[model samples]
Target: MKRHSIQTYRRIIQITVAITFIILPLLNQLGFTFIWGNFLNIHIGDLTLSDPLAVLQVTLKNQYFSPRLLMSAGIILIIAMCFGTIFCSWICPFGLLSELVHGLAKRVLPNTFKKLNFQISGFKIKIYILSLGLIFFFLFCTRPIINQLSMPLWYSQIFQYLFIQKHISFAVLFVAVILFAEFISRNRLWCRYICPQSFLLVIAKLLNPFHLKVGYRKEKCIGNKNNNPCQKACSLSLDPRTLNNLLETECNNCGDCIVACKKLGKALNFQFSRHFS
Candidate 1:
């Protein structure tokens, strides 16, 4: 990942962003809207996206949630927990946007955002709210429905907004979800702090070897050499110089370390390895 070519991964992300957010909407503008998402009963990966528990917990109108859908959700969850969030960087729009935001935040915030603290209790607030809210609402409200003020479905329903055309209420969730995760948390407060979709990714990152890790050559990391590139490169405020715990789980595999190491001559490098290690 160091001293190589342009990251085709980011290119793939840019292309997907265009096709999904741009092309799909443009197609809908021409009255090209179809129930393509519904014409099928179920597909293999559809479950992962539909996320039965996700849809069930929310106010969204379900178009698909077959048994296969449930199975895919389960399997992907198992995989993500063991493999870190390949989905976060590769598949999730929020994740990709967050990565972009990480770069932008560094440039813009300079002092404020970089110095922010990611306290454990601060991180736990999302899940605490989600769990307690789900129980309280289910018990009181007659509809045993799911609450989704912050889910991926909320976002997809956003893109589907330009297409749905008629009842655009679902778009409200889209807007609110985006405004909170995108504008507010900076990057991945939902995924890192609130998302159940993140449940497995957190486990996976905790156990996966391929997670973004800091290779700190202990002696050199101390600043008599007067160098601190790894600390500077971290977008997550995770200083590679101080990182001994791989179980931080919040590590998104963006190569801030690789970027940081260019000045340090490979003192800090990130490579694929077992999180179980």
Candidate 2:
């Protein structure tokens, strides 16, 4: 399928998941017992799908482990290994909002909203944040505290609360604050840097050298400085022209660059291969 079609599929998946979470809690409150719990700990029928980072934190510090949690996390990791952190693009509810916020900022205030390109990579900073979070969890027993930082989880929790308790949560404020910060930064600051939950999925994706990823054919590219649509289309500010191992780890394979290049040079397209091999 074309890159645009693939992106449309992703958006449909994202929106469906977001709406499902909102409805599940409401159904449960209305005497339906099929699904329960928020994004941190989801229970659908007899199966459970909990956040891996949250499970890891509790397991390490409290010495708690459940077969259901491991199974759920393992399933997610396996998917990530094959698809390269697609959860960030096609599943995570907050990603939709973040993308929208960034897109709006760029259109409304193009010059002022242009992000400050940092010399440092987001992966390095994300690793540091993950390490610090684990350390704090192990030392201070601050396990649930880290959950507050999860924007997607917060989105789910907000709906869960609104449905279960029939009230709004202050977590909506946290979502608002993060969206505002991302709007100002004009980048995916949280997903790229601060979101510890994504770190494990990224690591899982790195394990599979051959996976679905955006492939750049530099020779095919009709290099043009003024009409660099691929770069502009990239939400994470990654240069899709450089097809390498590093790009595999950083990119969520959203296919925006590929779509951007479609009418231009057709230089970028989705390919499954071991580029290093």
Candidate 3:
């Protein structure tokens, strides 16, 4: 029997997370208090998990430390340090939606619009946006303003508002609009450029030199240099062959490229090393 690809497993996990969140809110409404809260801060029995960026905003605004919140956020950051941004690839509901939308765009959109180039780096744009958001929050906001930018949080809260409060949130429209724009542009714009939530995860991943990343072996590669299947397989439009260079920071270790290369030359694989080489 043929083995399932990495993307198949990733899609399974992503769908499970998405469906689980939808169910969690319903369970909470029915007095199933074992797992509670949205993606910004969630509790599974005694264990807590939180978005690091949300925790940072709250910590900065309150000017006081909550050990529980700190530990919760630290756990996420530690995972990012060890495994890169797997949350983005494997668990985020928004990510799953974006990937599906992107895939549809690729299939239906014109070839001319498939590869649009941006003048500035997507990661740099994210950093700039993050800086401005923090500045704005520090200057005038009383609440954790950055938390509003989290798509995952909004995704979870959509179910929370529907099941618990019986309220229809406009956040569903907000997410739809973003997905529509991405489909039109044939780019995963929110994930690649606009997400402030991923900035902290990227930073955490950078801090750990030996974090999990796609390792490339040029010698093992037998495919056409001009037209590589690995590059075509990447949903983020990243080149797996050049992952050792500056482009490494943008990679979320989704392993789509590795799966694509498996039959061609088996040139790409996941590894934990100080450098991709």
Candidate 4:
């Protein structure tokens, strides 16, 4: 029997989550109230799961803390601490869509267009955006305004609006526009640079140095230093061989590079250690 790659399992989980959200709203409409709410705040019976950034924004805006909300968000943060933002690669519907769009763009666009150099670090830009948005919201907004920028929330809410309200949300067009822009640029601009929601996950992952991450063993590597298949396999254009500090923060443990390296030299792998080698 042929063993499936990590990406195959990741895609299964991603597709399952995407389909589950679409069906959840329909089930709620049909009078099943066991599971409710969108990705920003979801409840399954007595348990709740929420976006940590949304929870933080609400706590800041209201000057109050809800233990329930904190606990819900903590669950997600703990997962990030252990697995390094696997939420983006394994479960987010918008992520799955973005990856698909990026794949299509790479196939259709010219090679020259795909090689544009981005001098600014994407993670730093995300932190800057997160900081500026929080500062602006803290001074000027009354509500959890940052929640408005969550693509995963919007993705889930689209199904909620359609199934429960029988209304089409403009968010469909919003997400489509972002995907279209990414396709044209041959880049995952939103996931890579713009999404503020992921910053919390990145921070959580950073807090724990022993969290699961890609480890590259240079001795095991047999590929060229500059032009390796593992590097080419990265959708985010990251070189697995050099995932240190800021560069590591951008990796979601998607395992594409590991899979790409498996046949060649098996140099890359998932490990729970501080050292990359």
Best by lDDT: 4
Q: Write the per-residue lDDT of candidate 4 for residues 1-277, one digit (tens) a residue.
A: 9999888999999999999999999898789999888888889899999999988988988889989889999999999999999999998999999999988987888877755447467899988888889999999988778778899999999998998889999999999999998888877789889998899999999999999999989999999967599988888878888766646789999999999999799999999988887
Worst 10 residues of 1 by lDDT: 35-44
Model 3 misplaced stretches (Cα beyond 4 Å): 112-114, 244-246
Model 2, 1-277: lDDT tens per residue?
A: 6344666887889899888888887788789887877778777788888787777776777676777668887888889889888888988999888988888888886685558666466788888877787677777775656676787788988987787777899998888998898888887788777887788889988888787788878777886777789988989888887655447667998888888888788888877787722
Better-scoring candidate (TM-score), 2 or 4: 4
Candidate 4 collision pairs:
none
* 139-207 per-residue lDDT for model 1 (tens digits): 665432343543444545555555655446565655455544544445445555665555445654566
The segments of candidate 2 whose C-alpha lies over 4 angstroms from its true place after superposition are 1-4, 63-65, 110-113, 142-144, 244-246
lDDT of each: 0.51, 0.80, 0.88, 0.89
Error of 2 at 163 (Å): 2.4
How good is model 4 by TM-score? 0.96
User: What TM value does model 2 have?
Assistant: 0.91
How much lDDT does candidate 1 score? 0.51
Q: What's the ranking of the predictions by lDDT, best on top?
A: 4, 3, 2, 1
Give me the overall lDDT of model 2: 0.80
